[model samples]
Target: MLKDPPITVNVFDEARVNHEMTVELAFVNPVSEILRDCSLTPSGTGLLQWEELTKLPDLMPNNRVCVKLIIVPHKSGERTLLVGFDRASFKDIKTSCIVNVKP
Candidate 1:
């Protein structure tokens, strides 16, 4: 049985504050409603947003888990937003993204 690979998206500097590089993650899964009560934290920054999440109605399997995050490049290097799934959904799958904010 093959497992579905993790879904990743890039965050451009334009999305950041003052072109600082920001990313908005919209995580949706088949169990989104069930995990509605769940919360997410980016790099230990604490809960971001979830109340107004746009649920993705199309998700494989009746039981699934997804995550989204908006990251801002604080420095010149690459910063990865480690997505930690709560309630023991699955192992941690991290997605690394690069943000060049050199003006």
Candidate 2:
């Protein structure tokens, strides 16, 4: 699992309000497992949520998938977002990201 970088958003200022941020993730499945489903879990209150994304391609052996995550932050604080996937032949895989929110 690999992520681009940490995101910073300003949500308090009325003039320059930032309500959302986008995150890019690149992952590779080394085992022979079929990815069935994928979802994102944001930590803390309703400060952040993942926007609906397109379906992920079936991850075969030694295949990589790049996904874009649109996250909406409703408050001002730092939060962590977790990305999880269900595999047909193996345990699920999970990854996380840290975001900085300025008020």
Candidate 3:
């Protein structure tokens, strides 16, 4: 079995106008493993929780990836946040990295 890569996904809270945000990570393999052996760590929480990947799709050989992460806000200010991830995984997709936007 190939071990999954380690990734760090960041969150930007458009409401805070600062860096306060919540970020959780899940993984999808073309082999149909959704969130399998995945984990999430919130900033300053100092804790990591393991979660199951329920809705992840099967990974196909040479297949690309599309991550749908859940944005959980720790504060009560604005409830929405802009989402994005690094392009180190989806190299063949031929798309530009999405710029952070207002939510």
Measured by TM-score, the strongest candidate is 2
Cα deviation in Å at residue 49, candidate 2? 4.0
Report lDDT (Cα) of residue 9, candidate 2: 24
- Number of clashes recorded per candidate: 3, 0, 9
RMSD of 3: 10.1
User: Candidate 1 or 3, higher TM-score?
Assistant: 1
Among all windows of 10 consecutive residues in model 3, the one with the lowest summed lDDT is 40-49
* TM-scores for all predictions: 0.45, 0.59, 0.29
Residue 65 CA displacement from its true place in model 2, Å: 0.7
Tell me the tens digit of each residue's lDDT in model 3 across 2-93: 34433324443342323333443433333443323222222221111233232334444444444544433333332322222223333222
lDDT of 1 by residue, 4-89 (tens): 42434445445332333445543444333344344333451221222223333334344544444444444433334444333345
Q: Give the per-residue lDDT digits (tens) of candidate 2, residues 1-103.
A: 3243222222232211255566665666665656557432234344444434345666676677766655556766666555555444434455564556666
Which regions in candidate 3 have their CA more than 4 angstroms from the true location? 1-52, 75-103
Model 3 residue 59 CA deviation (Å) reads: 1.3
